[model samples]
Target: MKPIPLQRRPRGKKPLWREYAEALAVALVLALVIRTFVVQAFKIPSESMLETLLVGDHLLASKFAYGIKLPFTDTYLYKGDEPARGDIIIFRYPNDPSVDYIKRIIGVPGDVIEVRDKQLYRNGQPVRESYIRHTDPTGREPLRDNYAPVTVPPGKYFVMGDNRDNSLDSRFWGFVDKSAIKAKAWRIYWSWGGLDDIRWSRIGKKLL
Candidate 1:
C-alpha cells in the first residue's frame, strides 16, 4: 500500500530578523573564504605607487597568485604559485602584521638589489622601469633620502612603491618575507573621490 503523506504542521510565521541574520552570516563566511583563498579588495592609502596605483583606487588581489596561507595564522596552507617581477602586491607589514601595505615586488629571492641615484639596479644591471610616467632626463636622482644596498635573503623579496618619492617601504622598514605577502593586485575594479575624476585610459584596466 502506498504510504500516506504525513500531514503538514501549520507553517509558523518567521520573523524577518531571523532571515536577515542568516543572510548576514552567510555573507560573512563567503567574505572570509574569498579573502582567505580567492580574491581580496584593497585601497591605496598613499601616493607611493602613484602613476601606477593611486590613493582611493580599489584593486583586486588574488590569493592564488602566490599561494594560500592559513587565515589569521602563520601556517602554510598551500604553495601553488610564485610572485613575478613588477607585480603589485598587498602584504602584512613586516614590523606589524596587523597593518597591511601595498607595493610592487622589485627583487625576488637571491637578488642583489641596490639603488644608485634613484635608479634601481638588480644584479648589477639597471632595471628598465618604462612604466614610469616621467623621470629626469638629465640624470637619476635619489628616490629616497636614505640609501642602502640590500641582498634579498632566500625566500624573501624586496618591494618598493612606484612613487619612489612618497612611499615609506623597504627602504624604511626592511625586506618583506615571503610569508608576509597576502595577494597580487591584478585589477582595478573600482575607484572613489577625486581619483575617479581623473579617468586615465588605463583606469579599471588590468595590472600590467
Candidate 2:
C-alpha cells in the first residue's frame, strides 16, 4: 500500500493569535511615540487660564512645538525652536518635578518681568492682554499685584496664568526652565462646566 502523502505546513504564516498580538504591540508602540513626541491631551483642573481656557477643558498640546525630547526624560533629543512669549505651555513644576503645570510664557531669557497694580509689564512696557481676567480688581497682593522687576535668567522663562488673581505660577514658584517645558497648548478638543453644562462654544477653540 502506498503511504499517504505527507502534509506540508504553510511556510511563513503566523498564527492568528500571534498576528493579533503583534498588531496590538505595534499599536501600543505607535501610541507611545505619538504621546511622547507628537501630541498629548490634558484636562484643565483649575481656572488658571480663565477666559482662554476654563476648568474641565480638554485640550491637545503639541509636544514637538519646542523640540523633540527624550522619552521619559526632560532632555531634548533634537533641539529645535524655543518657546516664545505669549505661548501657553505645559511644564514640570520647578519646585516639584513630579507635578505638572500650565501657564503662558510672559518673559523669555533676559526679559524684565514686573506686575504693578495687576498690570503686567515686559521689558518695562505694559503688555496688552485682552485675554486676562481679573475677578478682584481692588484686591492687593504683594506678589500677585505688585511684583518686583526681575530679569529672566538664560534658559529660563517666566510664566503666569491668565487668571492673574488666582494663579500660582512663576511669580510664586520660580522660573520654568526651557527643559521643563513639555508641550505648547494647541487646541481645545472638549469642554464642559459640569454634567449639565457642556460648553459648545469652547470646544475646538484654538489656544493663543
Which of the numbered candidates is closest to the native, going by highest TM-score?
Answer: 2
RMSD of each: 3.4, 3.2
lDDT of 2: 0.92
Model 2, range 103-180, lDDT digits (tens) per residue?
999999999999999999999999999989999999999999999999999999999999999899988988999888
- Model 2: how far residue 184 lies from native, Å: 0.5
Each model's backbone clash number: 1, 0
Clashing pairs in 1: 48-163
Which residue runs does candidate 2 get wrong by more than 4 Å?
1-8, 72-77
TM-score for all models, in order of appearance: 0.81, 0.90
Q: Candidate 2, 58: how far from true, in Å?
A: 0.6
Give the residue spans of candidate 1 off by over 4 A: 1-13, 72-75, 133-148, 195-203
Each candidate: what lDDT? 0.79, 0.92
Report RMSD for candidate 2: 3.2
Error of 1 at 138 (Å): 7.8
Worst 10 residues of 1 by lDDT: 133-142
What tens digits encode model 1's per-residue C-alpha lDDT throughout 38-153? 99888877778878877778888888887666766766677767887888889999988999998888999888888777777888898899665333344544545325677899
